[model samples]
Target chain A: MARRKGVESSIALADAVAMCKVDAISAYPITPQTHIVEHLSEWVNDGELDAEFIPVESEHSAMSAALGTSAVGARTFTATSSQGLALMHEILFIAPAMRLPVVMAVANRSLSGPISIWNDHSDIMAERDIGWIQIFAENGQECFDLTPACFKIAEDKRVILPTILNFDGFIVSHMIEPIEYWEQETFDKFLPEFEPQIRLDVKNPSTMGAVGVPEIYYEARMAQHMALVNSKPVIKEVFAEVSQITGREYKVVESYNMEKAEVALVMMGSLTETAMTAVNNLKAKGIEVGIVRPRLWRPFPTEEFLEVLGDISVIGCVDRAYTFGAASHPVASEVKSVLYTSDKRPQVREYVMGIGGRDVRIEEIEDMFMQLIEVKNTGKDFPIQYIGVRE
Target chain B: MEHLNVFASKLVPGRELFSPGHKACQGCAPALALRYLLKAAGPNTVVANATGCMEIISSAYPDIAWGVPWIHVAFENAAAVASGVESGIKVLQRKGKLAPGKVNVVAIGGDGGTFDIGLQALSGMLERGHDVLYLCYDNEAYMNTGIQRSSGTPMFASTTTSPAGEKVPGQSTGKKDLAAIAAAHNVSYVATANTSYPFDFMAKVDKAFSTSGSKLIHIFAPCPTGWRCQPSDIIKLGRLASQTGLFPLYEYQDGKYTMSEDLPFLKPIEKYLKLQGRYRHLSKEQIEIIQENINQRYEWLQKLSRVSQED
Candidate 1:
């Protein structure tokens, strides 16, 4: 069993990575994500972790370097946020296309033009199509635990695709909370020594990341997509194994107080944890509100989401990232699209809230629930609401 | 040690890392340069190639020219990728998973990839001192993307992006001194070679791979299709380029500069420029300007080489 102690999530993430025994890390400093790499660098410098930390110039080179190391059968890592992630946008596609199992930590922050540095879903949302196994963490514990779980899930021979663990920039990354720090012995049981199946070996010469001509490009992409889709089972299996070792159950999609609820709030990231409190507050008043948080974002648990929306009349989806000119925000639009072809479809209301690091208060979440209840009673969906936006 | 002059008859091994029957333009200088480079580095080397003429020609999904383990990620990241490969192998060897001193890493890129977009990554790799050899095949422009002008494009050279017209002359700027820029990093070895002189180029590669530190070899690769020269004149142009003082063959090692092939008398710059259609439209005044520029640069190199010998 690991020792439970209170620490910042970034530090906890560093500890988890150290325990995982990665071969190399190449990362550039970016806001909110800096703390994670900073602590890892210190550990490397101090000999607590035996790894090579390549302080690359930009996120472009960071991802590029990570690709190199990963190609050579090394367990590699990198972290970035906002513009840094955006800068790495080109190579992000290369990671999964090449099937390199590099793990990355993305501290979710808003994309710029207005140049805000606070937390938002804009970063990860912008990179949704990069074909990596992506997941969201709602709290410090989840962030700390998912750090190592990402490596396990990514390096699995069945998966062998890159993975990104997204935690809301300041909310989860900077927040200090009680997290279980695993010893090397404990992590050894969860993640064994990595033995790469295909790598740049001089003895066995092979070409990797070769150009895909027009004739074979479609099949290559189709194979990549299938690999991602098939990773769903491996993700669950790894999570189950991790749960057994840690005694903390995890799932692709987690439900809170969804039993017998007519109305609910759908969300992801740290806001889901806040919504849980609002669910408790609404239950006190006989409101019967619930929360559905999609823990796995990329191979989005579509069936699980549909199953959770079963028998429910209305759902208020709280989205932190806007889709610009789209009809609704990111998560809300995905929810609506998935239910568009489903049989037992809920009247989903879009709530674009807490963007740019605005705190999602329990009162605001309660108000969202009330709005969902009203929509359920009237059978008329409210227009997408930008909560806390000054009219 | 055998003198570099006799290396042409020294019998290069028959084993070719870069296979034949690949797509490259007729009389392609970069292709020949790569052939010579791999001959020197041997089959024990892994290459990180950038997206360019070499990458596209060599790795087209089902048909790969590389006999050695090679990776082509993107246009501007071969150096960074090579850094990773070197570091990863270092750790693997440390853990006894890989045998030590068996493989060397090499990053190859075109002029655009090296002098422009890939410069930062190359700089970082050099400064970090990874045991990787970065080979920039300076074909002077972005040939794969339809002959666009790059930072390495010489002054008065007509490219698609930098055309010589009534108003604007070819490329207004002189070619960026990438060799000096690399030498500024104080890496273990830095050199300038041309495909016209394969023996000298291969000898430099042999010296570079002998050390276990950062090294960069900038090769002057002529593009017949891009430069609007005859395919038969490609190797001739490369020879004239160095013989005419336009592209000197030299090396910088441990703060010491030495000319591997210093001519007794530099031919007129016109001998080099007149063969290519890219510089066919240059007026007498423009030709003089180009000549003067080449003269001044060669003089500066002579001074540096003399100073190093004195020190």
Candidate 2:
């Protein structure tokens, strides 16, 4: 192995692109995500990766450039966060609507409030409706592993919507971890040459984006929507294929030893690792605990989530983001809806934590588990719990 | 609109590419420019629109005004998106999947979207030599945002952002020479068209679409609201704007210039500016100053008529 060294999330992303020898990257320099591009530019400068690094002025330009490059039969990637993602907010709808399987890494951060720079889920939360398949990772290891997988999932012939592999800023992005690195030949077999069904060409001379009058507008939009919902099955297939090749089992909604468990903790992003630590510690003391961590945020993985929480009485749905006076937290609201039709729906306990880079401790998570068990045992309800707040 | 089929009286047969019920004022010149553009480019072309009034109008919820494959990306990336579509087609053609030479990619935008916000992406597309025709329907202001001044706003033309007041006259700077900028890129073709003369405008649009490398057209699209004129006066303003030599119709192809319409004699500048509230504040001296500048620019253009002796 090439000397074991720790890499930042941004550095790890650049290294993945470098090591994989990705062909194209359309990037706009937004803070937090700029480090990855900086390292990528260096890689290109040193002749390490043969790629077209388009330095765009805005996030919208970045997505547009990526769309163009990908349409031209080139594998493409990009990175942005918060305002950049919001600015890209418009094209975010177009990329997947056009079904361009472009892989982007979103450095998840809080959307502007008082304008904070640290980690939260506000940005990607805002993009929830843009039709891009979203995946959140817990650490650098997941970030590294899921990047190539992102390209695979988005490029799947059945599911051509753009895919985003999100890792919280400074949480998993700046941290380092060990990774079982795979080789290029392995990927070559894993993802064969990108044979896109739809592409732009002079020879064929078919227009990709044409104005549709009212007569057909709804049909076109409905077609794009159906294509996205159709991506659910394809996502499962890609996960299976990746696990077979890498020998690391993956799921849209994955369970961490949740079987026969009374109370299951449900969450997303890197906080799951902290929750896992809490789960293990409590289980050692004869507490029945488990975690249902969501990797796929978009397409919600309703079936898999139902399976993961099967027969469980209570779910501690921890959302690291706040929706500001919705029914509850964004994730909490969605989890409640997904469990709407189930016969064995759990009594969901919504807990809000890890906002604005608030440190998520093992003890805090253990306390959440303890609270959920009681919520199940007593049939008593409490308002949304806020953990680790200073008075 | 200029009757291009003057002698034959043949109507351009097709469903409308730019339809009615847009949020635009009664008669915006870009609205007409799009009509002529669709006529020339034909129904076979795809339009990549930047996020602007045009996009908003044609793609509003539950209704679309376009008859062809159209897409609207963000404000400044229409050219890049067209490049993507063009490149996609190129790959499709190479793979023997897409039929060759049947479809055209056209990017349409206002002056704000084209001359300012989309400059970089447009420049990049021209540089990359994509087979895309970028159309700038120059209405002089960002009309979609309530008639604000853009980079293409004409000198002394009052706009919401460039208001004429005690301290400042409207739009203190001259209109940016966008066609020359495109020409500087050594693009295959670049042209200046006026909505007042639809024949000349459509001719340039046809030539642009027929060109292989990137071609750009800057159309002088008059806005009734922005110009503070009667809605019906749009066509008249467009024509008067050209007849006064304010927006001379011409084309640049193969590094040669051809003034599309001969201007042996032209109307005075006041004939063009007198109808618009934006220019209502201009004094005799200011109007004279604008006339002097227009004459000088046209005379300079006359010098480049490739066949001065032949003409």
> In terms of TM-score, which candidate is strongest?
1
Task: For candidate 1, write residues A123-153 as lDDT tens digits.
Answer: 9999999999999988888887887899999
lDDT of 1 at B137: 99
Q: What stretches of model 1 exceed 4 Å from their correct place?
A: B1-9
Report the C-alpha displacement of residue B265, candidate 2, in angstroms: 9.2
Q: Against the true two-chain complex, what DockQ does each candidate achieve? A: 0.84, 0.24
Q: Point out the worst 10-residue segment of candidate 1 chain A by lDDT.
A: A374-383
lDDT of 2 by residue, A20-63 (tens): 55667767777677788888888877876667666665677778
The best candidate in terms of lDDT: 1
List candidate 2 stretches off by more than 4 Å.
A1-12, A15-23, A42-50, A207-217, B1-47, B51-71, B83-106, B115-134, B141-217, B222-245, B248-267, B274-311
Clashing pairs in 1: none
lDDT of 1 by residue, B9-33 (tens): 4568767789998999998999998
- lDDT at A184 for candidate 1? 77
